[model samples]
Target chain A: MRIVVLAGGIGGARFLRGLKAAAPDAEITVIGNTGDDIHLFGLKVCPDLDTVMYTLGGGIHEEQGWGRADESFTVKEELAAYGVGPEWFGLGDRDFATHIVRTQMIDAGYPLSAVTEALCARWRPGVRLIPMSDDRVETHVVIDTPEEGRKAVHFQEYWVRLHASVPAQAILPVGAETAKPAPGVLQAIGEADLVLFPPSNPVVSIGTILAVPGIRAAIAEAGVPVVGLSPIIGGAPVRGMADKVLAAVGVESTAAAVAAHYGSGLLDGWLVDTSDAAAVAEVEAAGIRCRAVPLLMTDVEAAAAMAREALELAEEVR
Target chain B: MRIVVLAGGIGGARFLRGLKAAAPDAEITVIGNTGDDIHLFGLKVCPDLDTVMYTLGGGIHEEQGWGRADESFTVKEELAAYGVGPEWFGLGDRDFATHIVRTQMIDAGYPLSAVTEALCARWRPGVRLIPMSDDRVETHVVIDTPEEGRKAVHFQEYWVRLHASVPAQAILPVGAETAKPAPGVLQAIGEADLVLFPPSNPVVSIGTILAVPGIRAAIAEAGVPVVGLSPIIGGAPVRGMADKVLAAVGVESTAAAVAAHYGSGLLDGWLVDTSDAAAVAEVEAAGIRCRAVPLLMTDVEAAAAMAREALELAEEVR
Candidate 1:
């Protein structure tokens, strides 16, 4: 099977790990969201890309579902010691190496896509990973600060430093309107047997990927079964501050709302947790086929089962 | 009292600590060699400036004479894991932060001099540290590589990676001719009460600083007594491979020859180690006042005593 997966950070990374297990023989191409990429300490840190790479390559922290296992925060601690900070986004020593290498490559004039490929050379994540856009398309969150009122902060500062405590007025993918899809992104979607949108934050993750100028159009025109799993379970995000960003886009923090937000025009099939079974009718009523499954990825096996259901749903749509 | 000292890495940094102790009330301005400055992994690594800062700030690994105390090499280890590196120059996690901050500031359009000052604010290294040149003037050592034949390797790669094993055919301060003195360097030398050259590597360190267009002329014209301590004691360097580079510049590795190399026109006085007492007469014959003192910095007290001797010799010249 040739599958194209649009991924964000932790949730998408974990889901991809399961997808790999569900279809070991499948050729997977991951279109990693780059809106979350931030230049910290002058190094380009692609959180979503790194998370996906690490999780699938067996280097990810199992407990955290992101970053490297046995990682030390020595670099971050030292940076803090120098009074250089944003001390909130915990870049571990091992993780810092990836950024250092990526930044080095980028500084040497390598595109983000080329740099990602070079990085994946070591990880061998078993998937062709391409960024949504090679151009700068930082996700900025508009939030009300006590001093600055409604000011746009980089998505990282909003999520990491503020803990998304304040209400987000809007989520802006700063350069997406003009961003060309990274090399091979459109081709991956065009040739895919199935396209999966894992339980990543729809607004900032998959939504941001879709916001890039050519990417959304390419996926919609790909002529394949497009499936999505709801990040919301029991009317709250299974993990991460997805609801805060969802509200920024004026979307309700529910499985049915999230599926509807993606909509039938793009998504032919949607999967929700058994707990949100009642929302299945509400989602299917919107012209997209919806299935309620045990969507909680409690373990790799559970995640595999969820992937299997999504694949089966794609077959049903076909 | 105002003092200007031209310094390199470990030896010069150690000597500066002693200079600080010897003349506690003196306003010391350091002209650090940027010829030793290298870009590793796309970050500017100012070894000489960092050594002086860390040594004075009490963060230096005393035993090693460079790098941070109690450092971790997690970042280096991880970089190697990614198959990205020379993996020879041991930049610990703590040290990486310094480079990252410096590179970032430089990229933001801050000159190396301003970046050094900003960094020293945190180190509080006491001395007003300035690079010999704000412009890039990397020391390149021409050596015979087995694969590349005659190639100019960076001084750090020559010293750190090759262990200076290959004979240096030439030690070129690559951009010194076109480079101007860093913001405060010439002014510091011109207005100094005393100017001193610590036992730093002459060819790549002090010599490279002198190679910068106006610096050597400034010291020669400065009204204050210009004194130097012999990096070469007896017939070899007290520490470091100064002999390897001295040979490249066609200078003998002897206190008297080194004193003569600086010339009586620039130097008013020179201090040699007691072991090189016989060479004092030869140095004095070249029309520069010479004194023999214990130059091995066995301890801070010993270093302070050496500094005291250099100061007394400067007074004698005055």
Candidate 2:
């Protein structure tokens, strides 16, 4: 079976890890979000791309769910000594090397898609990983700072630096309007028998990917099952600042509300956690097939179960 | 009295520290070389600037004479995992932060001089550290590379990676021909009561800074005594690959030979170590005041003594 997954960081990486285990024979293509990519220290840090790469390559700091395992910060301390520190977001020395190589390759005139391929050559994540676009589409949050008022902060500053405490007035994927899908992204969506949105931050994660010019249109036009796992579960986020991000999009933090947000026009199957079983009826009422499954992915086994449920839901929708 | 010193990395930073201790009330300006600057992980890494900052700020690794004390390498490890490493040079995570800020400031249209001023503010190195130029002038070494067969490689790659083992046919500061001194550099030199060149790598360090058009001319024109302590001690470099680099420039690695190379035109006075006292007559024979003193700076006290000797030599020459 041809399976296409649109993903963000941590949760998406974890989910993809399980999906790979559960369906080895299935052709998996991951369209990773690059909006979370930040130019830090003159290097491109694609959080989502790194998460997927590391998680699949078995180099991930499993506990942190981001960056390579056994990372060092010697470079960071040296920088601090030079008094050239932002010091908010952590960039490990090991992690810095990746950004360095990526930046060097990018500077050498290779498009990000080609750079991603070169990076993946070592990871060999067993799935074809494609960036949503080669274009520079940064996810920016418009926040009302005391001094700057409604200033646009880079997604990392909003997420990593501020810890997302400030009210996000609006979230924008800068350059998404002009972004073209990376080489195989649209083709994979069209060729896919099933499309899955893992339990990542809905509004910022998959939403950012969908915001790209051709991506959402391609997925919507694909005459196949489009399944989305509820990132919002049991009236709270399973992980990350999804609730805060959803508030920026004016969506309430609930599974049925989020499912209804994706809507029937784009979604064929919606999988909510069993705890939100009551909301399953409401999601189904939106004309999308809804299943209340055990969606708390505590481990790879649990994640596999969720993937299995999503794939099963896809078969049922078909 | 206001004093400014031209410097490179370790020796320069260490000497500046003593200069601060020797003349505590003097407003010291440091015209640091940016030729050793390398773009690693998307950040501009001014090794000499950082070395000066770290050494003076008490953050330098005492044993290593580079990077921070008690540094960690989580970032490097993480970067390697992501297959993003040349992995030769040690860049700690904290060190990465400095370059990030420098790069950001540079990108934001701040000349390296101003950016350096901002950085030195936090360091409070008691020295106004300014880059010789804001422009990019990379030092490259022409070597018989196995990959390219006698192509020029970055100085860092040649020095750190190849350990300067290969014979350098030529050492060129790329883009230096038209490069001018950064704002404040010439003014700082012109205004100085005295100028001192510490025992830094003569070729890449001081030579590279001098490669910037206005700086060497400014020093030559400055009415104040221009004194340089011998980097060559007893027919060998005090430290570094000076001997290897000197071969490229066709200069002999002797205290007298090096002093003669600088000549009476640029140097008003020169200080040689007690071990090279015999070479003093030869240096003095070249029409410049020369002194032989205990120049091995074992500690801050010793470094201060060296500074005093250089000052005395400058007074004699004047």
Candidate 3:
């Protein structure tokens, strides 16, 4: 199968790794969301692309879920000695080099998609990793908090800084309306035999990618089976604050509701945790092939199984 | 007194600390060369400015002469994992935060001068540390070598990368003529009662600052003495490679030659090492007051003595 996976950062990276293991023959092309790319300490950091690349490339920090292993910080101390600090986000000294190179290359007139490709060349993250767009598309969250009232915060600030405590009234992917899909993104969708949305965040994860101008339209027009493994396992996010974002988008924090939200127009197949098996009939009633295989993805083996099951469901729908 | 100082990195930072110790009441302004500033790991780093800031603010890595003590490198490891590196320049983990804040501030439409001022608010480096100019003016050295014939290299690549072994033919602070002095730089020179050239590289340090528009003229027309402490001690630089740069600027690396290179119109006074007393007479013949004193500033006490002696020479010239 020529698989095209739309991914966010950590969760999607981890899932892609399993998907690769599950179908070694299946050619995979990952279209990563670039809206979260931030310039910090003069380095251009694409959190999602890095997470996916590292997880697949075998350089990811096992414990941290982000950045690299065996990093140093001599440069960082020198920078701090210069009294340059925000001191909030955890950017390792070694990690800064990646962002630095990315920023430098971009500043030297290369688009971020090309930079990501160049960066991925060294990592050799088996499958092709493409950014959603070269243009800036930052994810901004609107929050009503006591201190700032109704204020917009960058996705990192909302997630890393605020720890997502404040009620997210709305999650807007800024510049998505204007962002063109990166080269080969639409082509991959058009060429795909099957597209699988991993058990990732519905709103900020898959939803953000769909928000990009031509992406959702391309997927809708692709004329292939699109399957998704639900992130809501047993009525809660398998990882991260996927439910928090769901609330922001006014989607009920449930497996069947989320699958139905993707609907028959986009999704031909929907997956659920075994615990949510009771909702399978209801989801199937919505004119989609519904499956109730375990979707927790506790380890790589389990994740591969999930991917395989999703693919199987895609076949069933086709 | 409205005192101005021309300085380089660590050695200069330490001397400035002692200068503050000796002349606490003097309205001291530092004209710091930005030649050593490099873009590493995506962060814009001003090494000399950092050195001055850290040394003055008590955050300096006293043993290493650069970076901060007790630093980390979590981010750097992450970066390397992404396979990004120059790897030679030390970038600490804790230090990355500083660069993040600095880059963020710069991206937010703040000029480097104002950003530096804001950073110094926290570091509180007592002497005003102003960049020679807001515009980039990197020093390049033309070197004649066995392998490359005559090739121009960045000051850092010459000094740090190549170790200054290659005989330098010419030194030029690129873009300096077109580069304007940073706001308040000329004003500081114009208002100075005494301008002291610290024991720093005459070509790359003090010379680069002088290369800026309106700086040298302002110092000359300041209506006060311009006194300089000799970097050349006992016919050699106290530290670093003043001789290599001297070769580039067509000046012999001697107290007398350095004195004559500055000339009478710009310099009112010059201090040399006691061992170079004979050269002091030659300096005096150039119509500039010359003092032979112990110019080896090993510690703050020794540097304070040098500062006191420089101020006294300014007094004598006045």
Residues A1-318, model 2: lDDT tens digits? 999999999999999988998898999999999998887655688989988988998889988889878776666665665555567878776667777778878988998889988889888998999999999999999999888778999999999998889889999999999999989999999999999999988888899999998888888889899999998888999988888899999999999888888889899999999899999889888899999999887899999998999989999998
Better of 2 and 3 by DockQ: 2
How far in Å is the alpha carbon of B56 misplaced in model 1? 1.2
Candidate 3, superposed: residue stretches over 4 Å from native: A39-43, A67-88, A146-151, B70-88, B91-100, B145-149
Output the number of the lDDT-best candidate: 1
State the lDDT of candidate 3 residue by residue for A55-174, as single tens digits: 888878977778777655566555565655545677765566677778878988999889988888888888999998888889999999887799888988888887888789999899
lDDT of 3 by residue, B159-237 (tens): 8877788788888789899998888898888878888888888888888888988988888888798898888888798
For model 2, state the Cα shift of residue A43 in Å. Answer: 4.0
- The residue-by-residue lDDT of candidate 1 on A1-318, one tens digit each, is 999999999999889989999999999999999998999999999999999999988899999887889989887887787799888888999999999999999989999999999999999999999999899999999988789778999999999898899999999999999999999998888899989999999999999999998778788888899999999999999998999999989999999999989988899999999999999999999999999999899999999999999999999997
> Model 2 — interface RMS deviation?
3.8
TM-score of each: 0.98, 0.89, 0.91
Please give the clash total of every predicted structure, in order: 0, 41, 38
Give the candidate number with the greatest TM-score: 1
lDDT of model 1 at position B318: 89
True contacts kept of 1: 0.86
lDDT of each: 0.93, 0.86, 0.83
How large is the C-alpha RMSD of every model relative to the true structure? 1.3, 3.2, 2.9
